[model samples]
Target: MPRLLSLALPALLAALLAGCSGLPSRSTKAEKSVYQGESFAAEETFSRLFDANVEDTCEAARRALLSQGYVISKAESGVVRGAKHFQPAGEVHVEIAFNIVCVGDGPKQQIATAYVSAQQDRYALKKSNQAASLGVSALGSISVPLSSSDDSLVKVASETIPAGEFYDRFFTLMQRMLRENTASR
Candidate 1:
């Protein structure tokens, strides 16, 4: 009986320790603000600037812009060419650019630019394999993370803009968009 009791005591002690360790760690709460009235169309317009497939960054920018009461007049993609490079037997390197423009009531124009370039490989076999793999996995995954980071910008705009103003309304709409879109996920 004593031997059985000893074994059970150790198990009970281990369980207690494990339970204590599972408690949530300390985390700081983000400050929240309110916006009275804003338009949803502006937010949608900002979101449309990015690839429709990558909702997170677009949502972030959308939420930020809308919350500030900025109307989006234009959202389009354009290409810019950079210096060309040549490697090995006969291959050329090029750089492509993705541009976004969001206009509002005032002088400030919300613009975002993305530049992409192809990687150079010394060996033909390595370059071809890497390019294929990147096309399949890396390309699609890139935009998702970029969108997620837009939340920080939204937070900043929310805090900076005063309440009941045009910018305030825009930011408010942006916040609402983020909440609605993120909830669906």
Candidate 2:
């Protein structure tokens, strides 16, 4: 009987495998197109060409972020990173982080381009209920009816700011700062 059962199991497994072969398979071609950036154009929304050098461009980017209440976390000759926090509701918080890179783009390193990207992170307050328990000599264990909860801010979502107007405004500010710095020197 055991040998008969093993033979039947192998036959059943083969039949199930044969059935799955006829089913349609999912196409990954559609998913690949979602990540394709073939339609990108040089709109200059997230970047700006400057007549100054890379160092000057980076400095301007640092000032631009500082003027808007963003704390500069890292600053270098060609890179800058800053972040700003906001509280839109009692239980919701948001933070916008800015990353800037400046590189020479023209002849003799006289001209540079500054590229900027900003990502927004959202956080929501979460509350969790906890139960209290007590152990006594007479009773094995007793659960108290006291209600206790823990509240914490948890990150909900994060995404890069995709609006053209948002990046355009930031580039405009950087341009203004660059002009001011040139005038001061």
Candidate 3:
């Protein structure tokens, strides 16, 4: 009985150690994926806008109107809002909303409001293997999903613009209409 007990104890100890050794590797992989996904989403969205010079784009659009001999009597601060989602298959989708208000005094005060929405569907996957092997960087390779669809792009844009800008423009136009009516009297 003593001999049989001694053999069983060593085998049990060996099995326990083997299980513990694999736990750290699994934990590390999960941790890496979470951190990488967050960083990748942030970098993708901001980089595109900043690179495309969105500020410049807005300013230029404003300037073009001004050059046409229309005075800009008042301009309101623009608003931006957006949300992002990530998929298990390694894709990220983003939706953005933008709004601007501008008013001018002519025969009457005229207001122009513009709304825009945009989306980008691509993501970079973290180079987990390289990160583990190199031990120097955590950045990953970027990829576009094979099955990404453009359906959401238009839907997002439609929601962003029509209600906000259309109503704003209508009110501004109404104000002008009222002023003209009063003047004609």
Candidate 4:
């Protein structure tokens, strides 16, 4: 009976290990092809046509961003860049950066296309503990661990904002700004 029990325990352990080996691990494996050709579609998610010149289109974009409390990083004749920060949680911070480029569609400069892209960066507050070390002439160097912790915001994720109502709302705001400018003039 003792010999049989010992042999059965070993067999059970081996079978369990073999079964686990056949299962998938927790780590994720990336697909061989990251590009699924979804970007080849003729969608107007990243760009919009305006009936204004390049300068006017870019001006509208700048105004739209400024109206939404975005800090303009760069403002050129045909390009605009802005960023806005958000804190939705106690330790989570988010920043959305906007980049807009306007180009004339024809030499007549009557029509323009504004290409816009937004990137979202997420940050989390991370706390780390530090140990203190002291060196004294009377004794050798000694290290002591203190309860001190350092907190810092670490970037957790960054990705371009997907195409959808986000861009639609921005374009709508730009259109409104352009109309308002026209009315004011």
Could you say which candidate leads in lDDT?
4
Residue-wise C-alpha lDDT for candidate 4, range 73-165, written one tens digit per residue: 999979999999999999999999999999999779899999999999999999999777655757776656556789999999998887889
What shift in Å separates residue 91 of candidate 4 from its native position after superposition?
1.0
Give lDDT for model 3. Answer: 0.38
Pairwise lDDT winner, candidates 2 and 4: 4
- Model 1 over residues 152-183: C-alpha lDDT tens digits? 11111112222234434443454466567767
Q: Quote each prediction's TM-score.
A: 0.19, 0.77, 0.25, 0.77
Give the per-residue lDDT of model 2 (tens digit) for 61-177.
999999999999999879999999999999999999999999998669999998888999999999999886666757766766776999999999998887488988888888899
Cα lDDT computed for each candidate against the true fold: 0.37, 0.89, 0.38, 0.91
Q: Please give the lDDT score at residue 179 for candidate 1.
A: 62
Candidates ranked by TM-score, best first?
4, 2, 3, 1
What ranking of all candidate models by lDDT puts the best one first?
Answer: 4, 2, 3, 1
Q: lDDT of model 2 at residue 88? A: 98
Which residue window of length 10 is worst by lDDT in model 4?
28-37
Per-residue lDDT over 5-109 for candidate 3, one digit per residue giving the tens place of the 0 to 100 score: 999999999999999887766546645553464443432322111111233333433443343333444333433333334343533333322233322323333
Candidate 3's TM-score:
0.25
Count clashing pairs, candidate 3: 0
